[model samples]
Target: MPGRAPAAPRCAALVGPYLSGKTALLESLLFATGAISRKGNAKEGTTVSDSSPEAKARKMSVEMSTASADYLGETWTFIDCPGSVELAQEARNALLVCDVAVVVAEPVVDKALTLGPLFKFLDDNQIPHILFINKMDQAEHTVREILEALQAVSSRPLVLRQVPIRVPGKDGDDVTGYVDLISERAYKYHPGQESDLIKMPEEILPREQEARTAMLEKLADFDDHLMEELLSDAVPPKEEIYQLLSKDLADDLIVPVMLGAAEKDAGVHRLLKALRHDVPGPEVVAKRLGLDGKDASAVIFKTSNQQHSGKLSLARIFGGKIADGATLNGQRIAGVLKMKGHAGEKVPAGNPGEVVALGRLEQAKTGDVLTASGKTPSGYKWPDPLRPLFALAIDVENRNDEVKLTAALAKLCEDDPSLSFGHDPDTHELLLYGQGEVHLNIAFDRLKNRFNLPVKHRRPSISYRETIRGQLKQHARFKRQSGGHGQFADVHVEIWPVQRGTGFEFHDRVVGGSVPRTFIGSVEEGIRDYLVRGPLGFPVVDVAAALFDGQYHSVDSSDMAFKTAARMAMQEAMPKCNPVLLEPIYAVEVAAPNEFTARCHNLITGRRGQILNFGAKDGWPGWDMVEALLPQSELHDMIIELRSLTLGVGNFAYRFDHLQELTGRLADKVVEQRQAAAAH
Candidate 1:
């Protein structure tokens, strides 16, 4: 193994909670590996990651950024993913193709809960990941406490790879270096350079020994020989320890935690060295993804629409090689471009394990697997796009830009599948769905700056229905005289309330031809038209109308006269039927950490929800799923509040269950709003 060649070019994703310094870590990694001449600051808008205008203005990553570097003669590509929860789907898509992920975190116990969803996703997919505790220089809590908090959320066991070595400073103790737990060696940190090998400090020797023993025990759990050696009080050889560490990490049985301060370049080199040795190559990931490793295949993880280049599909080659103008998945490749953030260089070909942009793959979308044969491999799986939790009713300021807005939104949704837009049939609004408000705001910004189409957005309207409680029968006559032929017709219609959810029903119960068969159809058509806008100014449902009898003039009676007569009858009878508003109720299942279960319950109940049941969320440790029936009107901003309560890790899925009668002040307010909008 020692004499073997370096592994193929591998990819790693840097993922963590918001403001956890993933971009900073990416900069440090790039600068340390000589990919960049100088490290860039995210705050100063100089970082290679977060290069987009929206990201630079917000100083946060809104999408994933890809950059490649060379460390110890091995090529590595690192994807810096946005840490905000709203952009988590972007991170998940990038993680699907990577060989490993670096879960960056700050040394704060309270903020550890934010990593629950991210950790669950990595473990659930068996993706190998390392925990890098960034900003160790500003640490307030001990490393053990931080690890403990993280372990509660992670399903995999966390093993400490290094223990920070602190030295006395003018104000307080400073984390000057770290002691390697496996190698039993101490190194002193040097800013902007590799660490220096130093003698183990006697004062921290006991702590270092304890951490080393614990790491060894964790490794022994996966290896019988290592367990035997520990039981016999024999020290395992360094080679054997390294082998177990690599194997266990590749197997995703354990997460090795490393300490670092990316801003100062402290521990950055050490982190890179671990990645060079511990992370598996792309071949292993290819097998895990069920790729045959024989065909010319690539999986698209990200898509971008460039003004000049058109559509660029960022894909990781899984097998064989792809050159410019090659055919893949029945589509001709326009060109191959090597991507470094938003910029790209024309590449003649893309090889296995290298992430590159496939030019002009207009049909290719995120999570699409492309092969030369134009067929998807059997049983291949890709992560589904995350369910949208927030939405807005969007419209163009200039009606002339409607077509451009649609095209721009299509491109945006292609670039980030987490974004979606559609026309609501009931509400008749163009709704843009996404993870949160900030997520959609970034989309709005893209429409204005990238596509030259400015848009306006507002909260979406709820689809409220109107139903009747009482039954009534009304008679009406339509008579008009203007010329030689006069229009005259009479109708008697009975309206009755049916069971909830029965919808609208029309029946012709006429006998003895009291109303002619030709005119009866017209009478029912008028009733339906009237139902579209009920007396309460909403679509009417759960009602039945029957035309039992009517009179028709032999000479002047026509379809229009009968229809007008039926409409007049309904217009007079519906007000006496005691109309009521019917609001849609959804079966909502909220998933959150058990610690916040009580808060979730309060959040639901405070919104006029009825709890149905609560239980443990299957396959999710330390989490609970609370099921409830909540009205549609209460769910507009529920995600915003749920995240605020659960540290942005909570999410809910809901579907329309039934329609319930909505009475009282809330119903009155809804009806008033509907009538006012109708007048406008």
Candidate 2:
């Protein structure tokens, strides 16, 4: 009987921290596979990935790019995801549909902490991944040291698959090639070409043996037969070792480590071979995602609005073939296009395991699972978008473009679920929320370049409230003689401060018909309207008002008269009530490596935050989670500074905790600014 054929199509995602060369690796992969005639340089703005104008200008990826290639007569799709922490959601969405993730990283020991969150996400989802240590040519430390640093952040064991063969060069030691531990073969790397096989170097024998032994021991931990052979001091067959490695990787029990300099195309072919042989097929992933054996089911991983082509939904077919004009989720597929970066070619149908863009999926969205029966799969779960950490109050430059801006924002938010926009209820300002300053700037760039909407933004206003401290009673009368039914009303109202967070309350203590029963409600309405903008120029809370005494003329005392009198009484009484400002406080939890836990505490304290408690983050070894109560005003730029101090690995989640009194010079300054803004 003939050996079973390889899986037809497989998808892999390239993900890592910023500046780790994922795009470079993508370019090398496409070039080595002959998908492109010549490799394009990222810095030169010629690469297939990162072809967006914004990415070219920044020399970094701001969005995910997909390309398909054929290696060894098997189809493969590679998604090159943005490496910036601000754009991590793009990577997360892409990883969910891929067969494996190529976690590209540098050999720098200090920057190894940056991979902590990515590693945790992958392992938590039980997604199979390979650690491709890129930029090996510029490595400053030994592979062992780099691996040790990386192993600290990863929950799974790091199985070293290749050991670098260093040679003397113009700049100290250089990685000329790598030794394959499983194959027991040596190769010499040639720039822009495949590595050439060579005899095992005599000096590399000891290191190679040690690494290979370690690899076998890790595999033996998952294989009892291999453990028995090791105990007997017997060498396992190469085929048996390869099988065990593949099984362990597919089970997400080990992270196979590979070394390469993607910019130079070294070790590219070997990585491709490993992907072709070891990575599981889409069926395996489908089963893992609870869609096994289902027919005509596909999951959309990305959604985009193109310049002229309209909306495109990129989906990975899980069970059945999707053809042009096929109905999915009650929407007819207008077209099926096989995507290669920004360009695509129309295809008649998309088969299982292939990533294809379905045109005009206006009703479909990212993370939606589509089926031919027009029914959703039960108990299916997709990741919710990340909580927005930064915000900007935005306005359209051209007032005439306000309607256009709303439609454009809808499209943008659909493309990137992490982005959101809405009117702040307290301040009445249209605010845009995103990951950080850079992320929002990119959204602005898209609005201008893609949608032609020029927008202006500023730091969002804090939702500060005013409450009274002192209690007092005042009397006022409204008597207007306009010749016809002149208004006449008299009232004595008492206002008092309530406990914090008690909100507002109104009581009608009028007796003996002093104030008419019908006009009493009008008095409360007028007082409530005045509270909308209090004497301190903020919404008033935690206060109560009562209509204690009042006199009204039967003919002249209408609801309007009593309302006007109530307003006059409040205006004269509030200034003497001693109002104060209250700012919102949030309970924040910051996660970072334990080594930086002290710095995190200082960061919180420096920003007027009260540390609650900190301890080890569950399931995340060598990491700490610090809890604190932080003022909302201090969090506008906190993410930027936190990332700066923690090597871009720290992150935080927060929710409104309580309202605290604001005083001192800071409070004075806020009131001054409010008055100044009101004057304008």
Candidate 3:
């Protein structure tokens, strides 16, 4: 018989809170599968997953790293997401491409305290996931103690799959000897030699026999054979137990807890073997994507710019084979490689159970579908990041770097969704916003280190507008004589105030064509262009201008002539109209801890905020959302104080409310600082 068709490549996302050993686990998995010569330590900056210079300097992952392993004749693609909430969207992207998730959780009481919201996120995604309590070697507590802590934060049933046989040390400390629940065998780790598995140590076997029986009873509840074997004194075959556990794990029926020292590879080889066998393959994930197993469709999970190769679209092949020279979305692509971190070999086979990179795919983006062009493929949409803190305004000092900066930032943003940069129209600042301060800092570092785009970060300037306090009539005449038909245009215009947000308005109030009809429109264009640089170095707004009178030379009064006159007239009239700075105000919604109400109230009042309402909120304990209209000028540094008062748990979101008047030194500062920046 012909070989059975392979299943879809299975995908699993690795995510957890900050510093939860996610990187270490990937390192251990890669090395144990013989994919690498030696495992790299995250602290030593030699880890395969976080090999970027930014990761090395910060000692944390700023973006998601995609890698694959082939073991037991099965291929598994895994995503290692940044642990910080700022970059947690990396995990979200990982989930989009995967059928299952591995939520790496530290099995410690204090560490498990913040897993409530994260648990809800995973549960909501409907991605069957297992909880791995990593770093078991250094943890002071036992596996059971960590399980109970997780049980308290989440309502999910904490099932025991493996219990570490603790061996006491001389200082009254304990080290894990073997997993007692998996089998009755005992494991002894020798310092220099490989581990030894022997017949059950008679003394310790009895000590864990009761717990072993309880664990088997739970497993038997799902597998009928185990239940029958339990009563009949016929022990269930180990293969049958593994099958049931694997099925339930894939189905999200029950989560199996596994323990291992991610650094030492203790219990790691067995864990990865099980994952390769049990984790849903790409074929299965394609089913989850609502695809029939023919033709290729894969989500672009990552995009990286390589030094030698321009752009590498690292993706998982969901259905069908992606061979060399296969057309994607009607575009013929070149080269595909099965990646093991930074090193990958050109592989012709892009099978269902594989994680490969389609190099130099021009049409691909982070979430783009790689299907035959014009085919509607079923896939989940990318999640929008909720970035609360904005930081890092980057622009290059070198003129050449400035030319490359936009393209470089685009590639970086394509790689990591949490990283974003653009120019603010009102402030004229190239603003970069991210999940937090550290996040954008790392992004800037990557831009400089990886692509050699040297950039710097500074505070984003507050965006404000300029409007008139009262109407004023001003006339400007431009008469120049240099050659034949010298430029000459004279105009009289009236300026009036509109509602704060009515924007800019222009009307033709002339008769008999005092100014030629052609020049009339040119006058309005000049006024709008002048608005970008207003009297106070801001965008001019909420003012109406009308052409009441003008004189023009038919030959001399060209569009350029009227444009120059219009600029001069507006410049003269703005200061006389009682020009005032219009600063942006945000409609803020602050969900803060109740005890910080007084502090928040005082803080907002100090920032010129007008509170609309304040009341209690549901679902969150001791929290209230204070709705207010606050000036945007007051918001740049507002989060720092808000977080300080709330002990780092409070959060808020806001949008543009309106533009209001700016008086006093705040108005003076806007002009003074703007002039200073222009000078620089």
| Superposed model 2: Cα runs more than 4 Å off | 1-4
Give the per-residue lDDT of model 2 (tens digit) for 1-680.
11247786899999999999999999999999999989998889999988888898898999999999999889999999999999888999999989999999999999999999999999988899999999999999999999999998898999999999998988899899989998889999998888999988899999999999999998999999999999999988988888888888899999999999999998899899889888899877777677746654799988999668899998998878899999888899999998888898999999889999999989999989899787766656788999998999999999999999989999999999999999999999999999999999999999998988889999999999999999999999999998779999899999999888789999989889888788999999989988999898999999999999989998888988888899999999999999899999999999999999999999999999999999999889998999999999999999999999999989999999889999999999999999999999
Steric clashes per prediction: 0, 0, 12
Q: Whose TM-score is higher: candidate 2's or candidate 3's?
A: 2
The CA lDDT of each predicted structure is: 0.91, 0.92, 0.74
Per-model TM against the reference: 0.98, 0.99, 0.80
- Rank the models by lDDT, top first: 2, 1, 3
lDDT of 1 by residue, 297-397 (tens): 89999999966668989999988888999999989999898777787888899888999999888999998889988888776788679888889999999
Off by over 4 Å in 1: 1-4
Highest lDDT against the true fold, candidate? 2
Q: What is the TM-score (0 to 1) of candidate 3?
A: 0.80
Query: What lDDT score goes with residue 617 in model 1?
Result: 97
Candidate 2 deviation (Cα RMSD): 1.3
